[model samples]
Target: MEINLIFKIAAVGILITILGQILKHSGREEHAFLISLAGLILVLTWILPYIYDLFVMIQDLFDL
Candidate 1:
């Protein structure tokens, strides 16, 4: 819900794209794949806390 988080995600995406392209072009397709996977994990780690918080909020709202 913050602009900074959006910017961080966008930056990560852009960095992953660039790094993947470089790895692919250098005949390191495996490395590129790894980079993509790492990027996905990194993003998930960043967002997971917020996701947990959202769930907690929903449960509280419903008195569950």
Candidate 2:
């Protein structure tokens, strides 16, 4: 929800893209794939708490 989190996520994405490209061009396709997957999981871990909070808010709003 904060601007800093958005910047952090964008930085991670950019770093991961650069790393993946370097690994792929060097013929380490598997490592590149793993790097991409790790990046995705890392971003999801950052965002999941926000998603959970949203769900909780919705449930509370509806008296669920």
Candidate 3:
């Protein structure tokens, strides 16, 4: 699971970089910026649950 997530992030990063470059060179500056931001948000959405779970576990561990 960890390895898969690592690969997924790496791939997304590479793809976003390539996409941004392509968009910039194509004279779509605004769309390229938005595309990168959208990619970041998408990745964050996917990882939010895991982050929440981690915090919950920590809270329980310390009885917070």
Instruction: Give me the candidate number with maximum lDDT.
Output: 2
The lDDT for every candidate, in the order shown, is 0.96, 0.97, 0.91
Model 3, which residues run further than 4 Å from truth? none
Worst 10 residues of 2 by lDDT: 4-13
Q: Judged by TM-score relative to the true structure, which candidate is superior, 1 or 3?
A: 1
Error of 2 at 9 (Å): 0.6
Which residue ranges in model 1 land beyond 4 Å of their true spot? none
lDDT of 1 by residue, 9-47 (tens): 999999999999999999999999999999999989999
Task: Give the alpha carbon lDDT tens digit for every residue of 1-64 in model 2.
Answer: 9999999999999999999999999999999999999999999999999999999999999999
What TM-score against the true fold does each predicted structure earn? 0.90, 0.94, 0.89
Best by TM-score: 2
Candidate 2 TM-score to native: 0.94
Residue 18 lDDT (model 1): 100
Give the candidate order by descending lDDT: 2, 1, 3
Error of 3 at 46 (Å): 1.4
Candidate 2 local distance difference test against the native: 0.97
Alpha-carbon shift of residue 23 in model 3 (angstroms): 0.7
* Per-residue lDDT of candidate 3, residues 1-64 (tens digit): 3789878888898999999999999999999999899889988987998999999999999999
Name the regions of candidate 2 deviating beyond 4 angstroms.
Answer: none
